[model samples]
Target: MAGDASNRDLPPVDVAVIGSGIAGLFLALRCFRAGLSVAIITKKSLSTSSTNWAQGGIAGVLDVDNQAALEAHVQDTIASGGGLCDEQVVRSVVYEAASRIKDLVDQGVQFDLSAEGIYDLTREGGHSEHRILHSRDRTGAEIERALTEGAADEYESGLRIFEDWMVLDLVRRDLQRPEKGVAGLWCLAPDGKVYTLASRCVVLASGGAGMLHLATTNPPVSTGDGVAMAHRVGADISDMEFIQFHPTALAIDSQHPFLITEAMRGHGAILLTRSEYKEWKHTDGFPSDFSYMNRYSTKGSLDTRDVVARATDTELKKSGDSHVLLVTEHLDVQEIREEFPTIANKLAEYGIDLG
Candidate 1:
């Protein structure tokens, strides 16, 4: 691991990670445990990545009767992927999902649990079973805290985190063709000093370009720097068309869209058109009416994210509205308040409580 090497000797690290999100940090931790020196470079603090903003939980099967669940998970993923998913890759990740979750727990992540002393799994779009493991509403934040704490102990020892450092480009042996392999990176420090760190391997897990869209749930740092750099270095990039957008982002006029986690729907919230909601409230003063998703799929509100997002867009176009409403009136108020305190409180700012 090497950082703050402006005056000191720079050492070559075994691995160089160019992001501090869950993927990058988790990979760094694994490499460190295997006795590999690691360097993590991020333009901002470790907690500033999109990982800290994730609200929905990780999807996986933790119960013993996981064979069918795993199969369903894989199938659901493939279906949602619109037949473009690589079956081998899908199966590999699906099978390893539980073990990865266990690794997270081993690293100090505490997922939500039921009163029966079992992991309280919840459902989301594209999930057949309640296999999502979350820590209340702040699942991402909790995991980020745990991973940051774990990485801190290894920092400057087995791992070095370079915060406020921007990666300019990958240092490749042959700029003409990146097939030669990446040696390291050219980085710009906060003090306007440029430096380079050599490494045996470099990983670009720098996340997505959600900020490219006008309304996105992504943080400002998700400006597709990794993709751009990789493309510049002649790396093969794929699936630029498959950007996943959540269906229920909190749309306040002209404000950055805050994600309304799909887990809320998994917990029983139903999506409704503005007029449908208004009419329903006028009729009964409550949101017990059926949802538009019921007309599209048997899963209703539990349909896949792609389906829901498209449906919302269609409804918006049809009705000429800005956004849709997610009705949680059918769910228990106390349970919602307890399970999604962050969302509940945030909605309260806009004069919306679960009750």
Candidate 2:
């Protein structure tokens, strides 16, 4: 059926959480576990989250004994932040990474492990250690699945999940009050009807506005809805200028673009200039020259996201090309296929071989 709320009289809840991504779902689970009645309002299906589209794994230092690795994680984060990072936030995240990772596992999300049965951590751009734990290339999807299943188990126990329902705005306690307290939200159901579901507390977990770009890896719902709602209700939002752009995407003109994970680069893939790609496209393997990225940093392909993206932009402008290339030709084909089945299959569908 369509809008389930529109079909019946809505009930008041202890908490109304807007959005159904990882953040929203996780918060809802916690609140529900605490015996609070909860309702999750999502604009589309629960799966249409940027969290689901994320290809790389969660970054965390699972080893408590590795003090050096933990400090390196913090340094790597600050270094990648390009001096704009808050030292406190970097320290907090680096230190708490192990617990947060354990939390995910406790919630039934399984990250990839090596054949030795330990977590198969991988390094990505801006990382000094192999702290990125992924479920192959579709780490986000696996996370979404686990979290959604976690919610499903609680559904009958007063956890309400409303998919295909859009949150229009936050209802304030008193418009004239000095401190505007949140009462609930105005939701737009699939039947084109608006309904007010009152709550003791309202949480906005709506995601970012990456789709504001002409081309982005963000989903359609990432149009700054949560920010706009909070802003309209007099909430102060900061650090919005910080938008992380994935440096590489499959750039076939006639096809829709998809992200080419930096994980590829982390695992010895190289970025080639347009001419270089065309010149060596058919070659079985390429030289270990570290051509394009070395021009930006000594780390070459393993450079930070901003550096690599800037390097790609510079290469494009200098060569008058539309896009640069992510070359995997030099890598082991079977290993590439096994390690990145998601990406390998996707590229294969486009008449392209990842290696």
Candidate 3:
């Protein structure tokens, strides 16, 4: 099922894209639009990717009316990136966030919006303001749906999509004349066959290496394959220690760490020590029982992800507990249901009533 088309007299493709996640699909679509012959190779079905499991909305600068909000978000991101982020890249990504979001909308991606015609942006940890555009807690799924549809259209237009093909190794040939550079890859197909794929350009957008950690929010397939492959190919890797940890993954029976969006905290959910809540309830008067996150940061619960996660870890360690309570007393249960219907329903499976 996998072989160098050159061996079989098939037409050569202009580009070969590995992986069918958001990055790969979007790039393939762009290349197809540019009139280049393209092919996407995936190890499993195209739908199996880390992007599909994301519950948090993509962060973007959508509202010009909230310039401060935008600036704060940029600052928070930079801080969390821990000096590893290229300033230019960060700025470019931040500034272009709105435009990229618009591009997705133009491509038929529907994000949730408010009654006021504004994009319903939510705040996550490390964000200064509510700027995450979501679709009822399934933002990734919605975006993936749109991207996959667009990719299918490209496939119909003659772009090749080889599904269920596992890539083994890149087949690079040394130049005899010393002028021609490296060759291409030897990919493995599902049927236990190997094929050589020679291309002038090969793009690897395979995603992160969350599999090294015993406890990670990444999908099973997120085994740092791209990073490992790049390392084997002699690409200089940096900041291997820096990893982003979301604080509110559901602790009950989650096969993978099911992330609870920080938007819940942004909307006034409080992370509490069970002892604090219990002690306050048992006392004569409820003495301001709430432990607001300002004790951790000026931004309170809206502090950057690192801050929130560190605080959570420290609090849990001090309390000798595995999990802390997320109190949503200030938020209306009906509004929570309306805004996060999927999460509301998912929590019901564990007998945790969001109502």
* Tens-digit lDDT track of model 1 for 1-355: 2365854235789999999989999999999889998899988998888899998899887653668878988998998787989999999988888889999999999998899989988888878778889999889999999999998988846588988888989888887767998899988887788888899999998989988998788899999999999988888888799888778877787437778889988888888888888778767554534577777778887788888888878888988997788888768899889988888888899998664
Q: Write the per-residue lDDT of candidate 2 for residues 203-296, one digit (tens) a residue.
A: 9899998878888877888989999988888887799888887888888763337888888888888888867766665564464363677768
Top lDDT model: 1
Candidate that beats the other on lDDT, 1 or 2, i.e. the better one: 1
Listed in order, each prediction's TM-score against the native is 0.94, 0.94, 0.89
Residue pair clashes in candidate 3: 3-195, 126-303, 126-304, 171-185, 209-224
Whole-model Cα lDDT of every candidate shown, in order: 0.85, 0.84, 0.74
When 2 and 3 are scored with lDDT, the better candidate is 2
Q: What is the lDDT of residue 151 in candidate 1?
A: 87
Q: What does candidate 3's lDDT look like per residue over 188-285, in tens digits?
A: 77656776666666778787878777788888777777676666665578878877777888887555767777777766677777876676566654
Per-residue lDDT value at 340 in model 1:
88
How far residue 96's Cα lies from its native spot in candidate 3, in Å, is 1.3
Sort by TM-score, top down from the best: 1, 2, 3
Best-to-worst ranking by lDDT: 1, 2, 3
